[model samples]
Target chain A: MSTGATGRIEITDLGIEFSRNGRTVEAVRAFTLMTTPGEIVALLGPSGCGKTTVLNAVAGFVAPTAGQVAVDGEAVAAPGADRGVVFQQHSLFPWKTVLGNVEFGLKMRGVGKAARTAQARTYLSLVGLIGFEHAYPGELSGGMQQRVGIARVLVNRPRVMLMDEPFGALDAQTRLTMQELLLSVWREVRTTILFVTHDIDEALFLADRVAVMTARPGQIRDLVAVKLARPRAATVIATPEFMALKARILTQVREESVRALSGRRP
Target chain B: MAPAPDGGWQRPVRRVLSIGFFFVVWHYSTKWDVDLYVRFQNIPTPWEVLEEAAAQLRGAAFYGHILASLERIWLGFAVATVLGIALGLLIGWFRLAEDTLFPPIELLRPIPAVAWVPLSIMLWPTERSSIVFITTLGAFFPIVLNTVHGVEGIDRQLVRAATSLGAGSAAIFREVVIPGALPSIVTGLSVGMGVSWICLISAEMISGQFGVGYFTWVAYGIVKYSQVVVGMLTIGVLGMLSSALIRLVGWRCMPWLPRRVKDGG
Candidate 1:
């Protein structure tokens, strides 16, 4: 895979808090991580472990309460084209067609109509959504909507793509197909990605590194390197090495899940 | 036995039957000996009202009254739509605008449009302008408030997504804010149209020299109770047509909304 230059994410002592009903609730605290250019890293944790919060911080959606998040040595402040985000829910504008949604970023940048349409068409085909260009988001199935979301972000050619469980809402069969589709896309356009999910299998299948986080007030508890060979097939999950890694990660995640169930604050 | 599914003719048949039932009740009620019937004894029978309506429809004066009422409503409704959308977008998007403008609007919104008649008459030199002003007031609040609600209710993630795609505030407002709030805006328009008709009739009754409302009032003054019923029926038909037109426009603009919702199911 040809790795594109420009994507490198760094987070140092990142903390995020939400004030609800005049009560301060810390979502993430003292979290720190780094990704090399074109690296695929997954933030794997329990449902409310602030994995999405960390991803949002990188996407510049959430302001860090403390520390800093930077991309390519530049401090993250506001959302920009350099960092594209794919939300868990299908956030495609219902009013816009699939092609229109894909071309939105280019339109924002003032790209010419002909050029942007060509670029949008290219990305839509990349996600295998060529014929459905004129369809509205509401008409598509869950998996198809997420594909449009992916195409929309990819058209921007972002340095770093922050996906917050992009396929979380899909059925198992579709999720598997999407994972494979993502891997293929990543092979062609090697942008750095920070994928967030509560699914252990998804994290292992997609990321070069999986950073497992704790329960509420989440902090990185473990970072396991998936040394599995590139272009790994879906059959890799059945291999002995994959099983061994799964067992190890499962034990660590189960410990945190137990703590969360017991009403313990991390 | 299970009921048969409705056939093609069922809907029209049901409609005719319901309307026929109303006329039958009205016909008998007017002739009743009850104390309630005594007060309504002067009210015309269904056949008398229909005959008066037929005579009015054949005359140019009736058409003139209809045209005048329509002209006033169109002028007032057009002004209300433009001003309401502009002000609503400003109030919904900018915090400073909201804080500054919303309080006064909230205070004035509760005052009925008819209550503005006295002030409207003094504010404008012409009777036509005064009636238009009162009609504009009726349509404005619903459109503005619904638009504000539409803007406020937009999903935050959509805005974030647009911003992350490098959309500036202007682009976001045009591409995202407006389209996202459209469903509610259309709802506002439908409601605004209804209220505008109400205000138009009232204004015409009070101040107009040539309108359906004025015709009804004059007929009552002359004791032409049959002609008054005809005017009332004409207003009802016109009001229904106007609201339906607004809904049709809304449907065309929003193709993404479900068929059921667009049809107002």
Candidate 2:
């Protein structure tokens, strides 16, 4: 399969704020990042640290209050097919069959029935959901539904895939399996991915570079490159290098987590 | 544990027994010379009603009355469904439409369809149209309101997902909004069907020349109490069958709903 060239993402000093109950709350601030085409960049932060907000901005769901986000030098304005987003939960259209959900984007783009169905079937098989094509989202397990969500976006062949804790609601075993599945799929598709997650291991396992974010007024605090060998297995978590990296990132994450819990903004 | 061997037969048996109990009570209560119950003295026994129903069912004129009532219901319900769904979708999806269209509807909704009898009679040139108009009014509100609630209650993320997937407004409405609101819409249709029957019967009784409702009224006017009961039972059975038909269509449309819910569990 010939995978097309995916676009690069550039986030320059991005900031987002929301006004709630007559109070302006800064969700993200001076959050600068860059992702080369096909790079898996994970934004790792404590809960409510606004890391998802950054992904939302990149997805063009939210406008930055400061700075800018661009894909392939094109300014972000509104959500488009070039950028596909997989939400944490309830992403798939429940009313649609698994095949229908996968074909949704192509259908929206006016792709013909025969072409879209063939393409949808390809992605469905890629996600290991071939026999379950007629099943509705409600009938599937959470992991299966999320896989459908992934297939739905991957069929679009987006330049950038924005995932907001896509496996957050899964069990530990399912999460690990999903992470592995994501890695294998990413290797094939090689689309630029900005994955947001609270799990340190998940961030370390899936991303080329894990960008640790601070709490409240979230900003990128550290960018740690994972230099583990290619085709890294789940056993990599037991390796010395992986352990050292996890320990280092844990300390920084713990401090930000404490600050977040105490209602301190920095 | 597995179900009992007789489980399949149990429900039907119980249902027949339940219905038999009602007839038994009616027979004993309205027995001739049973002065113990003065209130039941004037009413016909179940046997007398059954005999009258058999005689009526044999007559060609009885079928005409049934067909007339059915025709009026079909026309009014069809009109209500089209208008209700269109207006509901518009009001539910668009803020401007909601603001402008909803207030008047809400104001008129509280007024019973029966109350519209005088206005309907004057507005339409024929009695049939007037009766249909009243029936339409009865079915309209439930369908419209439920559809509005269904649309409003749709998950925002579904809309966002469709948008991100390159869906325009029309595509989103067609794929996401319609299917998402369907369960509620089906509920509305069912309720609308029931209410339409109520309004249809009332309108027919008041002004209809040939209908089951009119037949019942004529029987009562002539003190033929057994035929009146027969007409009432026919209406009840017809209303039930129509409601079940609506539910059957709902089940077919929403294959995504669980089997239990689809089967009316």
Candidate 3:
């Protein structure tokens, strides 16, 4: 069984397609990535570059037309509790209180009420929403709602966390703060996280390695490793290393976006 | 003060005032002092109707008629709610059932609750059961339709989120589907309850041996203007009270739901 310091995920040559009005659209084309345990990898690309499709395939929401997605030596044939996902829209159930949303996973696992509440409370605290456990999701601000989304995934302690532009909806300032918050949480848990984003600075700030993808027919263009020091903060965005990484990623994104707009294949 | 966007309480107050104004206009119009076929004695004033209603309240017959009508409405309304919510959840969730059953229900929905009265009377042995059946038919469609729509309209992400978190099918339905669709379900029930009252009054009028409808019909036959007015007021007050009760139930169950414009004000 795969375990301990190295949280491994191996995806080989994945392809996904969407059927629209009897026409087949190629959404993902021959994507591939491999990372050892405890590594945070960002799938970075432009808006139309099919970055989210790859993450969905990994999370088991979408099936790849070809190839495989394996996490910690096990084939991801279906969505399991092992791979937690945070959606871009902050999909906290509006009817449920914050604690109920956090406790949902434990309940699904058939954990006792006592045990689940204890687990949920710990997770709520991790996301800095300890006092607001009984509050419903609708009462929260956008940033706070996203924090609930984050805490929900973290509590499950999955082998891999598949996040689809988790901080995309936040303002620039809040985004930076959330990025730092995520870094601190990731530092403690050391979970292998597959984070998806179109933001260049975000890709550099949070991920250990950034996997750049091409247009519609997305595939790994480059795997640039970001070896910045631990415990990253908002200030990390201003550093020379961060800017250098951001510049490289922006070039890749601009090329991909141009390719998409031209109505040409990459 | 530039009151809140919707002077929150004013709409209800306005609705009540409008209804009162209409009655006042109706009462003044009924004063056939100029030229009318029916005399002022036939079309009584609002004050005359209120006086008759107050006088009738002293009698047990009026209360008895009210109780009978209330009993049938509560019964049929209750039956429809239980069946509608359950069947709605099933039809809403399963595509095959939705396709098969929904078409027939949609076709039948346009048929008035009163239209079902003759068929129900022919089918049922007892008057009470027929009344209940017609009322159920009346209330059933709105509640079922709304519940299904509510369930269908649930945020897809919420279902995906709960399922991804490892919730089983049962938990998904209970914690996610039901609560998520609650706003819609309650809407259906409130409408169903209102419809039930409409059907109950009609049904009572058609086959009532001892209800408000029977009393009103008999009064009209004998040209008892005061009794007719009394019966009409009883039905109106009872209908309004029942609807208010249903709305109160909706409020207590779903404080999270947005409050809409109230009726009659």
Candidate 4:
């Protein structure tokens, strides 16, 4: 994969809090991560560990209470096309056709009709959604919808593609297919990506480095770089190197999951 | 028997039978001069009412009455649609607009449109303008309220996604807020269409000299019971047809919505 020159993401000492039910709840604290241009990093943790909060901070959907997020040294104060996000579900505009949804960022930048349409079609074809341009999001299956979501994000050629469990809602078979699809697309586009998920296999399969996170008010517990060979297939999971890394990361995640469960009880 | 499958001929057959049963009961009641406490004794027979409807259809004056009422409803409904949607979008989207505008609308809304007849008559000089004003008043609240609800109920995630996709505030409003609120806006329109008819008819009965409502009221005063029934039926048919037109138009505009399943189901 040829890495793009400009897609670096830097998040430093980020903290986030939410005021819910009249209480200030700390969701994430003292979290820091950075990626080289076109590197894939997965923030792996149990649900509610504020793994998503960190991703949201980078995507400019959430403001950090302590630190800041930067893309290519430019600080992110608000959401922009520079950081494209693929949400877990229901992110597609139900009213817009698949083509329209993919064309949205280009349209916002005032690209002409012919140029935007051609560009959108290219991205759609990349994600294997070439024939379904005119169909609405409501008509597509869950897997196809997320394909549109991925295409929509990639069409922007974003500096960082932030995925918050983008395939979390899909069935196992679909999720595997989507992971493969994402890797192939990432290889071609080579945009920086920050993926957040709780699934161990997903984290190991898709990411260059998996940053295991602590319980709520989360921080990185471990960052394990996968040394497995590239051009990975589904069969790579059975390899000793992949399994050893999974075993190491699995213990950290299990410990965090236990802490997260106990922390919620009282 | 088990329920007929959906989209079957049995359902249509049952619907036809249901209407036929009502008409049969009506024809028999009037023919028998059934004098319950409610009194069907003075009520016109179905045949007599049909004949009177045919007679009215033959007259130029009846057409004039129908046209006058229609013109008032069309003018009032059109005005209400434009203003209600504009005001609703504003009020629903921007908090400042909501705070500044919503209070007065909320205060004024509960006063029924029929109650506005006296104020409307005093406000506008022409009878036509007065009737239209009342009709507009009736239709406005529902349209504005439904639109506000629609806008408010839009998923915040959609807005976030749009913003992250490089939508400015104005672009978000046009692309996201407006379309997201459309189904509800169409609901408002359907309701507004119904309310406007009610207001028009009441206004015409009370003050108009040239509408179907006015003709019906006059027929009652002159003791033309069969013609009164005809007028009532004409109003009913027109109201039904207009509401259907709104639905048809709404359905056409929202082609992206799934056909088999109703929205919010």
Candidate 5:
């Protein structure tokens, strides 16, 4: 038995449009989506593909111009403790130490100082940052910083974890280590994760299902389930099923990109 | 890398040589009997100024005058700081206050504190209290202006982070807003010290019975040029000391703000 049988996230016919600089940008075009219980769903797309925008919509950062989003049975009206979000840029407050950042969500949830510190330390151990509790975010390397970022989001034990390009900023070696670290993290909590990324390999490696999206004014073209076995290791990268899914997602992305460049409506 | 000067008696030799150059020039010019006001013409000689300053320094009245002026400066500065920071934060945080209070403050800020000399005199019957009032007004405007700028300059993200973390208004202000606004508060303090120093001198001349400003002004009335020079030097020393004290207090309060430069400016 693996840690992959718990929470759920549901998104229905969501749409978002914004007016910036006097121009109407249809940032999200009639996005309809869902991720079932205990599943890691990856929103795969290129830059300007509205992958982040869709994540924002679901996270309650943006008002949907069209549809509905629900976690378990409740509709999200604003950012809350129940749905933890890790931004693409790692928006950890610079003034706080590693422990402080990890304890932020817990503190907001009204947990006592003693209990929050203890729980935060537990999550820190899970992410291999147990010893660096007092270190500031600026004092750590990019990968170490992101590990704190993951640890900060994970400790809350949210029903749904919304991540936007969580590893897009790391170096290649760091990215791979982070991918392994993320797998171990998922194996522990198995919270319903909607992880957004442009990296096909990362999506293949972690996600139980990958929803590859069409380019800007973005729409979901396909949501393919990755049936790869869990306790998935770094060596999973060399497997046939991994490579095969990579090829399929690549084709979907490239086709959508061409259609996007051709000025044809996606 | 600046090494120590090569000569064993370097600093003492340099100091003596500079003084020697000045006296030699003065003594020679006086000895040659140049028709021009050579050594003590309109400006007194260095020796004469020192002698008069030493004589004044020995007097109890001189210390009393210095103490009087110093008292006014501190009192006015203390009052200005609390009022300025409170008003600045209010204007910065609330849109209604910015609209209602700031325009009036801007109108009053440009009027010189000296102009308030007559106004303060009319408002208060006593000369000593009047001088204090003017000095307070002088320091108040700059403190308020800088504080408002500082409060407005706070990072928006920090505010959002606090609110999202469930911090109420009081905690947000005490834990976040004050510390975040401290660097700017220090800037305001430094500027206000300078302005108060300037206003204190003028206020002293107008209303003081015995102070450095009054001593200097009174000396000008009688033509004791050497004593006037001494009084001017005293004011400069006092001003420097006061500014240093202001910066010391600032440094103590805002330990997070970097201390790379002492703009004792």
Candidate 6:
């Protein structure tokens, strides 16, 4: 059930390099991926595989040294409201109440106070945080804070939502609950999502297509499409088809992680 | 944090008893004319100081001195607060402002307030203005430095998040930078309040016709030793009250801080 027809993220021959202490370090090389108008794609790989670097390029946080990222036929040169990003943790403004944080985007866009408040309340309720309107970020649990982060981004209604391991910091039980919550939210909002994560189950459970990348100087090694049915539950993970896909992906991830460790030696 | 002293009236009673024990020791020390490596023989007894304080409390002139010192401190502190926070925000958030403004500040920050006394007296037309100038200079550095530290210490990810949320540069500064730096700014204000008093008293003692500092200096000159003790006590009490006022305002502004954090402050 696609709700938006505008979020078509296109990355072409993207490469990113960082210079540190007079040394040139290539983070992502020839890493290219594209998404259809309401697709959820997970960039899955081992830690330091530059999966996050790829996502950052799409979010316009880091400039690509070699190619370009375009959203809906327009080149992305800087961060904009059209693309919203949810960081892993501590992204919410500590000084702001939950309601204020959610309304920040509308406030920045110069929306009048009453309209923004109404819209913010709507999204906060969507994330099941109606009673915590005036609570500060520091007072919430990790999972609750991430929910606020999601609502904050969704309220902006960006063409694409970029999440960098948003649930990675939560406990395992909380992460599972959040994944389910996110799937339900996605079913309604239907904006394109580019999720970055290292967890195999998480990548398979939440994404329509998982783009697996090789370790450092990361490149897409495989693009596996999840043929699993919609409205997936945790029970679906124990099924044979899910198990088979998990086995294949687990092998690839282990190989890449080994290679990544060995390559660190002098 | 020290188990919160078990949360009872015992804490307050113990505090009173602790101060009372100190008074008892001081009274006996002067009464017995204790003279070891340290000398309490010439010191005023606690009884004599209490008598002087009672006498001073009844006089209108004592209230005038208190009012004069408080006015100087308030004026200097208010001006320093405005300038320090404004300049600090600009300096901390903008590279150009930092480069252009910080070098001169760095050069001047090392000069102590007492060192500026003679020059400030010469620079300003009035004794009052010069003393205020010293007080302002004393308070400004801590506030501005702490504010800059606060701004620079903000997480880079927060700015990125704000930008992605459609915030322009001005909006990021207002929404993220200002609020992020607020806890530290409050810390700066509290520190600046303390430094303001120290500078005000030093300036007043050096050259002033009124104020507690001047009253204390004149008491020593006239050999009103008990009055000198009373003035010193007044300065201590007033400084404590001013700090409490700052802590109160700090709590009011940052309601987001948890109660534990509020207590730690």
- The estimated TM-scores of all candidates read 0.95, 0.96, 0.93, 0.97, 0.78, 0.98
lDDT of 2 by residue, A1-266 (tens): 23445568999999899999998999999888988888899999999999989988988889999999999889999988789999999979988899999999999888999999999999988888999999999999999999999999999989999899999999999999999999988888888899999999999888889999999799999999999887889999999999999999999999999999898634
DockQ of each: 0.80, 0.75, 0.62, 0.88, 0.22, 0.87
lDDT of 4 by residue, B187-251 (tens): 99999999999999999999998899999999999999999999999999999999988988888
Under CAPRI classification, how is model 6 graded? high
Model 6 spans with C-alpha error above 4 angstroms:
A1-4, B5-10
What does candidate 3's lDDT look like per residue over A116-138, in tens digits? 99999988888789999888777
Quality of candidate 1's docking, in CAPRI categories?
A: high
Model 5: per-residue Cα lDDT over A18-110, one tens digit each: 998998888777787777776789999877888888887766667778788788768867665566777655366655788988897787767
Q: Candidate 3 clashing pairs? A: A6-A37, A7-A37, B12-B265, B15-B265, B16-B265
Residue pairs in collision within model 2:
none
Runs of candidate 2 exceeding 4 Å displacement? A1-5, A264-266, B1-12, B32-38
Better of 3 and 5 by lDDT: 3
List the RMSD of every prediction in angstroms. Answer: 2.5, 2.6, 3.0, 1.9, 5.3, 1.4
CA lDDT, candidate 6, residue B11: 87
Candidate 3 Cα errors over 4 Å, as ranges: A1-3, A264-266, B1-27, B30-41, B258-265
Candidate 1 scores a chain A TM-score of 0.97
How does model 1 fare in lDDT?
0.91
**Candidate 1 per-residue C-alpha lDDT over A63-107 given as tens digits, one digit per residue, 9 for 90 to 100:** 999999999899999999899999988599999999899999999
The full ranking of all candidates by DockQ, starting with the best, is 4, 6, 1, 2, 3, 5
Q: How do the residues B1-265 of candidate 3 rate in per-residue lDDT, one tens digit apiece?
A: 2335956888889899999999877677777543466455467777777788777877777888888887888888889999899889989988888998789888998999899888899999999999989989989999999989999998887877876788778888898889877888878887887788788878888987878888888888898877887787778888778778877776777654434422211
Q: In model 6, how large is the Cα lDDT of residue A59? A: 86
The candidate with the higher TM-score, 5 or 6, is 6
True-vs-predicted CA distance for residue A144, candidate 6, Å: 0.5
Candidate 5 or 2, higher TM-score:
2
Q: On lDDT, who's better, 4 or 5? A: 4
| Alpha carbon deviation, residue A31, candidate 1 (Å) | 1.9
